[model samples]
Target: MGSRIWKSIAFVAPLSGLALLMGFGEQIDEGACSGTLAFEKSRQLLEERPEVLDIAPGSFRWEGDCRFAMQGYADVATAGAPSRRTFELLVALEPRSHRWQEVSFSMGD
Candidate 1:
């Protein structure tokens, strides 16, 4: 009985360890998306554009490893007037510097 229990533990131990490692990796990826770095980088890039007047608080979602998508409402300049519109930003982490970079941006109704 003791030998059988030992075998079971030996089989389960590596699997549990692997699961924990994977979970930890996922948490890190989520943090990168939800944390300030990704959002701030995206906001900065958007604000730099002349048509983007202002940006509101937005939500961030993980796209994949080191990539994030941010969506929110923005005040965009149209016909020399500011209009509220929805915007989306795709950002990715720079592997060399670990900084977020704007991949793409779009604004729509």
Candidate 2:
């Protein structure tokens, strides 16, 4: 009798927890930054720069209500000599109707 009761309690407890989590799952704000037009704009911006070394898709993520973080690469010119190297690029974006309202770019050493 004791073993049977323990088994029933274990099964029912996990199911009840799962039901609560499903009912009140956290809302991720991925939708606000997503749409067909937004994606097209992003693609265009990525293509315009000839200095870009490479880009990792899906690297852009929301930072807050109107800001985002983007990571990629850009070619950097070395000082005192004629040499070029790839730098880790980090940027922030502010959204404007299907386009970025503001963008700040930087290189990480």
Candidate 3:
């Protein structure tokens, strides 16, 4: 009976460790800068701005904590004319709502 218990423990330990590793690996992958919940929320906010006509898929970089820096090209309406401009945004995840909020935004030619 004692040997059987030991054998079961030995068999289960490796499996438990492997499961933990796989779970953490997925979390790391999902936490990447671009394809995350924060990025999607930021994109939605940018699209809703009145001056923004269109936005291209942007590059993203982690700004530590729950903040991110995003840069991309946008077609913006300026003085009744549509022009492509480079834009930068700083966004942070709102912990309470699990949503993203724009911290700062800028655009220039």
lDDT per residue for candidate 1 within 21-102, as digits (tens), equals 9977655443343457777788788889888788885788878877878899999888866899998899998777877888
Residue clash pairs of candidate 2: none
TM-scores of the candidates are 0.61, 0.37, 0.62
Query: Which residue pairs in candidate 1 have backbone atoms (N, alpha carbon, C) closer than 3 angstroms, thus clashing?
Result: none
Whole-model alpha-carbon lDDT for candidate 2:
0.53
What is the clash count for each candidate, in the order shown?
0, 0, 0
* Candidate 2: 10-residue stretch with minimal lDDT: 82-91
Query: Candidate 3: what lDDT?
Result: 0.82
Q: What TM-score would candidate 1 get against the native?
A: 0.61
lDDT (CA) per prediction? 0.82, 0.53, 0.82
Better of 2 and 3 by lDDT: 3
lDDT of 1 at 89: 92
Window of ten residues with lowest summed lDDT in model 3: 26-35
Worst 10 residues of 1 by lDDT: 26-35
lDDT score, candidate 1, position 49: 88
Q: What is the lDDT of residue 28 in candidate 2?
A: 71
Candidate 2: misplaced stretches above 4 Å?
1-31, 35-40, 75-98
